[model samples]
Target chain A: MPYIKIDVTREGVTREQKQKLIAGVTDLITEVLDKDPKLTHVVIQEIELDDWGYAGEQVSVLREKGITAKKQ
Target chain B: MPYIKIDVTREGVTREQKQKLIAGVTDLITEVLDKDPKLTHVVIQEIELDDWGYAGEQVSVLREKGITAKKQ
Candidate 1:
């Protein structure tokens, strides 16, 4: 079983977006890793700004100073 | 750096419980894996019943049928 966990900031992600993520990840795993789609589990987690940290500072504090953690 | 993610169903998990989980997991990793606690990141994610699937069915549907996923 291939279990994928995706963590993102709690920035108003919609249900449709979550569905797309699950489907896309499943497809990717099946295509690349050759995992069974039925056994693939994609879990999405949205962390609050205050809970996530970067470079020894909370994300909320970083946002206050105009610093952002980009997905790349 | 060690990043640990714990996923559980959204079933009224309290904030105090989450704090305990973080501390307990950190201590476990430090003792077992010898990882630095400062570099350890423990994230807890609670999934909706409808979002988590098991046995080819959604968790909510399984719950309606008196089936539960246990932590082991």
Candidate 2:
């Protein structure tokens, strides 16, 4: 069994987008690694700006400080 | 910076239990890996019985089939 998780900053994610991701990730795994779709678990995790940090500072704090770097 | 994710089967978990997990996981990462708590990302993912699988069967199906186990 393979467990997959997607972590993203919770700013403007829609339910439809999440659904697409769940399906896309599952299909990709099935095509690439040949894992069964039923056993291939995909989890979407949304993290708050305040809880996400980079360069020794929270994303919220960085935004406040006029820093606009994106995570890819 | 360290990112730790915990995947658990959703059943009878309490909010208080999740809070403790966040704290304990953060502490463990900080102590063991010397990571900053502020940058330490801990995401707890709860999967449904119907969404989880083991030994070529869904957890919900396994439970229905009288198979119970734990994940650690």
Candidate 3:
């Protein structure tokens, strides 16, 4: 099975949007990768702005550089 | 900060394969999405064949359909 994982910051996405994203992603994988939709697994997680860090800097600072943003 | 989570079955990928996958993915995100490699957080989780379910079917059976194969 082709195991796929997607990790995205949770700032811009809403509950409904997240659901749509998941379904769309599954469909995309099925269509392009030819994976079985029935056999594919999807997971979505919400993270706080303060908890994630990148490149020796916290996300809050990264946002100043236009490198990170809330999902919305 | 985009909290991206990836969950995949741990059948086909090796330690080196996993590391390469992670780096390749980070590069992909940076190049395609314009996200900073420093600010991005990557997570890789290994799931068992028995744990992942799709379309109401377990992955073990899904493999029989050729929908999924060990990563190789």
Best by TM-score: 1
lDDT of 1 by residue, A7-67 (tens): 8888777766766677777788889988877787766778899999888889899999987
Alpha-carbon runs more than 4 Å astray in model 2: A1-6, A9-72, B70-72
DockQ of structure 2: 0.09
Which candidate gets the maximum lDDT versus the true structure?
Answer: 1
Candidate 3 chain B, poorest ten consecutive residues by summed lDDT: B26-35
- How does each model score on TM-score? 0.55, 0.53, 0.51
- What does the lDDT come to for candidate 2? 0.76
- lDDT, candidate 2, B1-72, per-residue tens: 788767878777665566667777777777888887877766666789999888888999988887777654
- Can you tell me which runs of candidate 1 are displaced by over 4 Å? A70-72, B1-6, B11-45, B49-72
Q: What is the per-residue lDDT of model 2 for residues A1-72, given as tens digits with 9 covering 90 to 100?
A: 989878887778999999999999999999999998999999988876654545334566667888775655
Candidate 3 per-residue lDDT over residues A1-72, each given as its tens digit: 444556665466567765665665555445433455765666766565566666677666676677644222
Just chain B of model 3: what TM-score?
0.71
The two-chain DockQ for each candidate, comma-separated, is 0.14, 0.09, 0.22
Better of 1 and 2 by TM-score: 1
